[model samples]
Target chain A: MFKELIGKRSAPSKNVIERGAVKKFAEAINDPAPIYIDEKAGKASRYGRNIAPPTFPITLEYGAIEELVLPTKGLIHGEQKFHYKRPLFVGEEVYGVTEIKNYYERTGSFGKMGFLVIERQGTDAQGELIFTEEQIIIINEAARKGMPV
Target chain B: MTAMTEIKVGESLEQMQMPPVTRLDLIKYAGASGDFNPIHTIDEEATNAGLPGIIAHGMWTMGNLAKLFTPYVEDGFIEDYAIRFRNMVFIDDVLTLQAVLYKEEENKREFKVAVVNQKGQEVVNGTVVFRMYEVGMAG
Candidate 1:
């Protein structure tokens, strides 16, 4: 179904991690670690500043690329994996790009479904890879049937 | 305060149970994470989309697992974490999180984690790798 989107890579999008946003995200996730919010604790730690939680980068909204658009009516995330070179620090400007890794169709108890795999790479301002998140999303048959032109 | 001095494979870590997930939590998460996906909040929309009703974000469950390790882990200690959403999570589902020490090497430990609903159904399964500053961080 996403044949044309396979192998397409999105343009690199940049983001600056704000400290307040990191605190809000950590709170939302209900993680109360001092490194994510307490400034005095942050100054005394090894990083010398506030840092984001491990999965914080998942919230970064990179502008969608037209070539990589997929029907989202019934899309649901299936599997996700995160690998990190280091924890992202607040105030660091990072860049990321999304690429369509694979796509396939299979029949299951729920009926025919399409599985799309996407890989996202986050790099620091200096262009070093910080983390990579790979996600697999499944589109049910009903959703696939309603694809837009 | 360190918990352990020696680490062994095939050992069970502490088990934790979380309060039932409520719709209020979902809305708060959406606002904080900036993920306004209706499936996470709007019940009517979720029903229209053929879901069981509003569902919790997969990331929220993953983040809960991370919360279990805050006491023992350094702020940025996670090196790798992966999970598969095995089943859907509905409001009022109380989740139990369990972890087992799967492997150990010099300055590193791997844990296998499972999140199960009250009915003993696995909602999510995953593994996490941690670079330990010292052994026996888990009590």
Candidate 2:
């Protein structure tokens, strides 16, 4: 159903990797790693600053595509993958954009399901690639029934 | 710090047993992650959506799964992570994270990772590749 969105890319959105947000995120996950919270530890570490958790990008805002619409309540996050060239420092600005990679339907135990694949890319101010996150959202029959065809 | 030489490809890492999932935990995660999806925090909304009360965000489970590598953070950082949500995680469901070394290289180690509920059913499973710091390198 979302096939028309394939190859569509959104405008770049800005995100600042704030330290307080990083600390809160680290605590929320119950990880007390000093490198993520302690400035001294971070300075001592190779990265020269506090680094964000691997999955911290989930908190960043990605630009939106006008045509992308799905029920937020019933969709399942089926799969996720993140590849980082280097960890994000606590105080850096990243510009991120997302592209609809592919879309398809499958019949699982829950009946007809839709799989929407999107790729988000984050780059530094110089436009250097920092990380890439690919995610698959699963739309069950119930959720798909609510979407616009 | 985990010495690179001591890692064994066939051995399992120490498992992390998390406290039972709580509404407060989900609320805190929702705020921290900027994912305020009500289905993860509101029972009524979840029921209206045909769910069995509130469910945990798959990212929450995925974030917790990365805790398995925290102990080795000083040794290296997680360079790549991939996971599939195998089942829904509900409130009060006790989760445990486990990882077994599946591959070891000169500068990286790979692990087969999983998170299971109290009944031992896998809720999420994936692989993580950790890029190790060169020996004798200062951090």
lDDT of 1 by residue, B1-139 (tens): 3342344688756778888999988998898788898999999988877787999999888877776666554532778889999998899999988878888776677899888999999899999887766544454
Q: Give a tens-digit lDDT track for model 2, residues B28-109.
A: 9999998898989999888877788898989989998898787776678888999999998999899999989989877878
Model 1 DockQ class: medium
Q: Which pairs of residues collide in candidate 1?
A: B4-B136
lDDT of 2 by residue, A11-104 (tens): 9999999999999999888886998999999999877889998999989988999999877656778899999888788999999999999999
- Model 1 lDDT at residue A62: 50
TM-score of chain B of each: 0.88, 0.92
Lowest summed lDDT across 10 adjacent residues in model 2 chain A is found at A140-149
| lDDT score for candidate 2 against the true structure | 0.89
Candidate 2, superposed: residue stretches over 4 Å from native: A147-149, B1-4, B135-139
Poorest stretch of ten by lDDT in candidate 1 chain B = B1-10
lDDT of 1 at A127: 91
lDDT of 1 by residue, A60-142 (tens): 85556577656768788899899988778889998989888899999999889899998898999889999999999998878
Q: Rate the local accuracy (lDDT) of all candidates.
A: 0.82, 0.89
